[model samples]
Target: MVKYPNGTFAAFRKSVGEPTFKKNQKSNYYRKNINFSDRGMTLEQMINESNKFYRLKEIAVVHKKPTPIQIVKVDYPKRSRAVIKEAYFRQESTTDYNGVYNGYYLDFEAKETKNKTSFPLKNFHEHQIVHLTECLKQKGICFTIIGFTSLNRYFVTPANVIAKAWWTQNKSSVTLTEIEEWSVEIKSGFQPTLPYLEAVDYFIADRKSKNGKYKI
Candidate 1:
């Protein structure tokens, strides 16, 4: 129970009725992602919500690419009912998502890791690096959304960074310190959820600045 300035115990909230379990404890949000403040939704769900927010505001259009499916056998028990008994997911040739933001072509892969110290390079595939490198060659914005689930931390890491790491024979994973130094941290929120566009803006602007072509 909480006490007011007068030192009286706080009354129960009538709107919520009586307590069912233990009292609620304040969350330490400074160390955790804001959109994950509730610790309920997955990274994909957060990104999807952020995309919806951007679309509603006419900011930029982005979406996850659906994996191609091959239906081998189908059973129709009724005239109006069809059940897919056999199917296989077709092989993918690209990353998880691709679309346009402002004038830049955005392409990325969303990944999650349970490990706390580092993200394993084994989680990334050679084909993904090749595809992203190709996209970069076309002057497109290519990157990744890496989520450390156990730590509840997230980073916007560039594809080239991952590519470079993969090429190093002895390197097996990327450390948290390396990520903090090289990647842009995403600020999660209630409205946009992931709020990743801000990171994209920063990424593009930083690249342009380094290339001596940064403009307003």
Candidate 2:
């Protein structure tokens, strides 16, 4: 039972009606309020939602790559319930996602960083870097979807730019200024959340204009 600020049950009774639950019966009340201020989705989650929208609209085919893992230990808490207690990666994964868009093979990694000024190079693994480079060699549209969580900004940076920086740059991170120069900015939207295919299209057009080929 609840009472109004005026110390009267009249308002509560009117709002909820009479309680009809008998003794020993369970009663569940509907929640009237929900807070979503701290419920923002992660970068990968946003990308997954976008991929789902794309598939539903027949706009593109994209999927997150599932990492292979070896389950070493399992615990049966109950007869009908089991839990994986220990697992290990079977092998180093190439990238986060892969798909075909506009007859072009798209392979890329999705990453998020909390840093405001730059993205740390340590976020990427050596094998992943090699994989991106190899994909670029096969004329695949390879790139990275980088999200700056602190700034709520996203960019699609080409793999070549990343490779160049990884090898030549002395700095341990890629600055936001450099990303702004080499990458295409992605805008958040309601339908797909992260509209990154637009950035991919931008790269295709830019590459065609420069070399008469969609190599990036």
Candidate 3:
């Protein structure tokens, strides 16, 4: 039986579409019996590990923001047991990671795509852009670490570049060619997993050389 408002099986199929349910199924973050160090972990996991490594070595203090949740219902089935039945996102999150590095307030977001041709704009949230803009105004170092999983390429693109593209571009995505010109690709390393600070250093150096002041 079709549960959609269309009701009829054929109509429901047309509305729901075929293979989309499976195609949209989220992939597992962890794989059983697989060596992630060789297989590669998710961008989030890699970044988390890198942050821990950096902190332990007194390199930086980056951390992920905990998104607030609104609890709707709770059930108490036992004397010491309480289960959350319903919850919702309280509000839009600012960005993924933020911290201090060498007297600079660093703020950034990490994103990944399987598409080889372009990075779609749909992956970004409007509130994130607004937050980045605010950070820029405060002279905070802001950027995005984008990974093209299919191409095995990772880039540290400035937040301003992305913000401008989002506002000026007429298309729904930023082309790979454009990103290559605008971004600095970071080489993957075994020690830090994602040594993104290397790219950040390059960006800061360029900014300092360009106008004699490197605030962002």
Which has the greatest lDDT? 2
In candidate 2, residue 208 scores what lDDT?
73
Expressed as tens digits, the lDDT of each residue in 1-216 for candidate 3 is: 111112122221111111111111111122334333347688888889889988999999999999777777889999799988877676667899999888888999999999999999888876777788778878788999898888766777778777766655465888888777767676566557778887777656756775522234
lDDT of 1 at 64: 92
**Model 3: what TM-score?**
0.76
Top-scoring candidate (TM-score): 2
Number of residue pairs clashing in candidate 3, backbone atoms closer than 3 angstroms, sequence gap of 3 or more or interchain: 0
Question: Model 2: which residue pairs collide?
Answer: none
What would the per-residue lDDT of candidate 2 be over residues 106-171, giving only the tens digit for each residue? 999998899999988888776677788778778889999898887777887778766666655465
- In candidate 3, residue 183 scores what lDDT? 71
Q: Please provide, for model 1 over 93-133, each residue's C-alpha lDDT reduced to its tens digit, 9 standing for 90 to 100.
A: 46888889998999999988989999999987666777787
CA lDDT for candidate 1: 0.71
For candidate 3, what's the RMSD?
A: 12.3
RMSD of each predicted structure = 19.4, 22.9, 12.3
